[model samples]
Target: MSVEATGETRSVVTAATIREILVERAGVDPDVFTGNELLSLAELQIDSLAVLELQAVLVERFGVEIPDESVTMTVGEIAAVANEDR
Candidate 1:
C-alpha cells in the first residue's frame, strides 16, 4: 500500500509482500496461499510458531512488527500492521 505524503505516495509492505514472506519464510505452501490474501493464517493451518517466525522475518526485512502474537490474522491484516509499524 501507499501512504499519501506531501505531494507523493510512499509504498509500504503489502499483502503481496506478506504472501511472499509466508511462502518463503514461513514455508507456507504456494498452493495453499493461492486461495487469497484475505484468508487467515489459521484457516490456512499456519501455526503460531510460524507466525512468530514470520514476525522476525518482517522485522529483518521490513523493519516492522505486528504488535502481538496472532496466528489468526490474514496476510492483509499482517500487511496493515507492517504498514502502520513502518
Candidate 2:
C-alpha cells in the first residue's frame, strides 16, 4: 500500500469534486448538494452511515479525514475539512 495506490495523491479537493463523490459514491442527489451548502446532512435526510461512507471516500480518494461530528457538518464544512488538511 502506497499513497498513490490509495488514491491520496490529489492536490486539492473542490466543491465540485466533493459533490461528485457525494452523488456517485455516497448516493446523494446531485441537485440536493447544490443548494444551501450551509445546511447539515441531517437537514437533507442523509443518514450518518451515508456520511461515514462519504468520509471513507474522502480519505481513500483525497486523504482527508472527516471529523467525528461529521454528520452535523454542512457540505461546505465538509469540504473545508479536506481543504484544511491539504
Candidate 3:
C-alpha cells in the first residue's frame, strides 16, 4: 500500500524502503545491510549526520516525521514508525 500526501505518492514504509533511502541518500553500502536485521542505527554505523539526512528523506519521500528518540532504533523499527504515521 502507498500513501498520498501533497499530491505526491509515497510507498508504504518498509525496511527495504528505508534501506534504499539510506543507500541512495546517505551513500550507505547496500552490502552492509541485511534488511531484516534487528540492529540499531549505531550498529549499522549510521552517524548523526546520516540520521539527519535520513529524517529529511523520510519526511520528503514518505511524509513521515521521525521523532528524536526513534533515531537510535533499528531500521525495521523506524520503518514501523513511519508506517504508523501513514
Candidate 4:
C-alpha cells in the first residue's frame, strides 16, 4: 500500500501486508506473524507450498522478483528488497 512520508510519498511493503497475504491466501495463522521480528521463513513456520504462494503474491502485488535462493530470508528483509525495487 501507499504510505505518506515526510513530503515524499512512497509505497510500503510491510510485514503486516505479507502476513495478511499469508493468512488470507495461504491459510497461515494470524498469530504466527504477531511481531516485527526478523525471522526466516522456516522460523516463521512457513512451509514450501506457502513459500511459493508468498512469492507469487509478492510478484503480483509489488512486481518484485524474489530469488529462489531467498528461502532463508526474513519478512523484513524481503520487504526491504521489494521496497528497493519500487
Q: By lDDT, highest first, what's the ranking? A: 3, 2, 1, 4
lDDT per residue as tens, model 1, 1-86: 34345555445888888778778887878788775667788888888878888889888876677856557788888788778734
lDDT, each prediction: 0.77, 0.78, 0.80, 0.75
Worst 10 residues of 3 by lDDT: 1-10
Q: Which one wins by lDDT: 1 or 3?
A: 3
Off by over 4 Å in 1: 1-11
Global fold similarity of model 1 (TM-score): 0.76
Which runs of model 3 end up more than 4 angstroms from their true locations?
1-10
Instruction: Write model 3 residue lDDT over 1-86, tens digit each, in one string.
Output: 33354575557888888888888998888887765387788887878777888889988876788877665799889888888845
Q: Score every model by TM-score.
A: 0.76, 0.77, 0.79, 0.75
Better of 1 and 3 by TM-score: 3
Query: Local error of candidate 3 at 21, Å?
Result: 0.7
Clashing pairs in 3: none
Model 4, 1-86: lDDT tens digits are 43444455545888777778779999988887777367787888788788788889988876777767555888777777767845
**Cα distance off (Å), candidate 2, residue 35:** 2.5
- Whole-model alpha-carbon lDDT for candidate 1: 0.77
Worst 10 residues of 1 by lDDT: 1-10
Q: What is the lDDT, from 0 to 100, of the residue 38 in candidate 2?
A: 78
